[model samples]
Target: MESEIGAFVAVATVLTITPGLDTTLVLRAAASQGTRNAYATVFGISVGVLCWGLAAAVGASAILAASPTAYTVLCVAGAAYLIWLGIGMLRRARNRGRIAQTSGTARMGSTSAAESALRSWSRGFFSNLLNPRFGLFYMAMLPQFIPDDAPHFLMGLLLALIHNAIDVIWFSLLILGVRLMGHWLNKPVVQRGLDSIAGGVVIIFGVKLIIPVIFS
Candidate 1:
């Protein structure tokens, strides 16, 4: 059991470190929004993982894996959301000059603290929640780690916790790395560049998710 748990953690850590939607979101936040918002995004993503973990542990996420209709619906919805989000970022990049001029005063005044946090948090949360992959991944992966002799529910939850822990740590490090390069990363030009890259990547992910459904 101990060895299996260790193996699970090792695998989870590798997956957590791999670049994905979560990484792109956090990178954009850290580069453009500031430290507070970046951390908020990380927290939201962690919460999202926890929700999926719980669902998987209890076998609720089987709906996503077992039902093609449900999976298709979620895939389309998630793809739409990602494309929308990416478009917004690309627009910001396009309007970077005007945005830089008004960003300090107008931007802060237009968006309240609470609204900013909520937006950032939701970006992270929904980015994971809507994408049914998390549920499917958890469903397929957790069972493999749990011992037949152990309680399935308890073991699954434990593995999920380990996965989430790795996520928090890995994302925090990413945020900190961005901060360490803040001087250059915070520049309007640099921010726009990051936004463009992140936005394109996000859109590609969205397109990839929906392409199979379209062809099928």
Candidate 2:
């Protein structure tokens, strides 16, 4: 049990730090909306982990893994979702640097904090959920660590806890880093540039996800 727990921590740490859609979404949200919004995004994303963990524990992920056709279908669906999201982000980038202001003054409070948090949560949830790799990650990786004698439910839950805790810590630090940008984070030009980069990266991820499924 002790060895298993240690292994779970090590695996979770590596996986959480691995660059992925979730990381990008959280960081981008933080840059755009500051720390509070970023935290909300992290919270939503953590919920996603909870879902995945539960699914994994109950053998739901295993079913998907065992059925090649179903797995492929889901992978393709996830890729399509990412492409759609990337397109939307790119479109938003068109107006990224052009915050409406009164005369020459910037309207600091055009959007409320509540709205920002909601938007961040949306970004985080969709970003985490639609990343096809996430499902595969659990499907491929989690089983490797579980002993045949280990209780599946207990192991899965523990693994999920470790994964989410690591992710929360990593993302929190990122939000803190972006918060350091402070007032400069409000600059429309910087935000727009970030949107453009994020859009392109997400599109590339979508393309990457599709190519394999199509060819395979």
Candidate 3:
């Protein structure tokens, strides 16, 4: 059991640190609204991961994986959503100059900071939730950490918590780093560059999700 937990932690750590939508969203939130918003995005993303992990524990992962049509449908939806987000980011980059100044107001805007935080949180949640593979990732990767005959409920919950803990830690670091670069992130040229890069990466992922892999 101990060995399995350790292995799971290592695997989760590697995956958590890998660049993905969650990381992108956290960085975007932090860049746009500072550390507080970044934390909110990270929390929301953690919630999504937890939800999927719990669902995987209950065998929903198999159900989704078993149905190619369902998986395809989810892939299309998620891909479309990502593309939309990319477009939005690009638009923000194009019109950043029009936005109100953030001289020293903690990046507040027309609405309260709390509202922006909630929006960031939702972005993280949906970004993860929409990926059908995420449930399967938990279903597949997490079981490697459990004894074949072990009771899955408590064990699953524990693994889920560990995964989320990794998430929080990595994203916290992202927020901190972005906070340190707060000045650079909000600059017009830097913002445009980020928008272009993030947009391209997201669009590529979206395409990857939808494209069928051919085997000889």
Candidate 4:
């Protein structure tokens, strides 16, 4: 079990570090908002991961993985969401000049602290939730690590928690790295560039998600 866990940790670490939708979202949050909101996003993402993990443990994820109809439905929904989010980011980048002036006032406006955090959190949560890949990944990977004699559900949950923990650590490091460069990263031009790149990546992921469904 320990060796299996060690191998799982090694694999999860590599997967977590690879740039993905979550990475783009966190980087954009840190650069555009601050560490506080960025962490909120992280928490939201973690919760989403845990939910998927739970689903996998209970055999819920297998339904989506095995059922082409269900998977395609989720794939399309997730793709639409990603494209929508990406378009919003691109618009923000285009209007970054205006954003520089209006952003502060907007933050100070009726948007309360709770509201702000909820918005950021939701952004991360839904981004993860709507994607079927997480469900598929958790279902496929967790079984590989579970020992023959162990309880499947509990073991799957444990593995998922481990993956989530690693994700939190890696994302926190990314937030810190962005904070260290806050001075320049927050600049209007830099923010614009980051938004553009992030937006493109998001849209690409969305397109990738739906392309197979479309052609199949």
Q: What RMSD, rounded to one decimal, does every model reach? A: 2.3, 3.0, 2.4, 2.2
What local lDDT score does residue 191 receive in model 4, on the 0 to 100 scale?
Answer: 79
Q: Cα deviation in Å at residue 77, candidate 3?
A: 1.3
* Candidate lDDT (C-alpha), each: 0.84, 0.74, 0.78, 0.85
State the lDDT of candidate 3 residue by residue for 1-216, as single tens digits: 999999889999999999887787787777766787888888888898888887777777787779877777788888888788788877876776575545643476656877888887887887788888787778887767778888887788889899999999988888888878777677766766776777777777767766752210
Task: Give the alpha carbon lDDT tens digit for every residue of 1-216 in model 2.
Answer: 678678878878877788877777777777765667778889888877877776777778776668888777777777777788778778877865464623212222455768868877876776666655676677677777778898888888878877888889999888777777656766767677777777778888888978988888
Tell me the lDDT of candidate 2: 0.74
Query: Which is the better candidate, 2 or 3, if ranked by TM-score?
Result: 3
| Candidate 4 wrongly placed segments (more than 4 Å) | 100-111
Models 1 onward score TM values of 0.91, 0.85, 0.90, 0.92
Worst lDDT window (10 residues) for model 1?
Answer: 100-109
Model 1 residue 59 CA deviation in Å: 1.1
TM-score of predicted structure 3: 0.90
| Tens-digit lDDT track of model 1 for 31-110 | 88777778788888888887888788788999997899999999999999999999998998888867534334212344
Off by over 4 Å in 2: 101-116, 147-149
Q: Give the poorly placed runs of model 3, Cα more than 4 Å off.
A: 104-106, 213-216
Of 2 and 4, which scores higher on lDDT?
Answer: 4
Model 1, clash count?
Answer: 0
Decoy 4 TM-score against native? 0.92
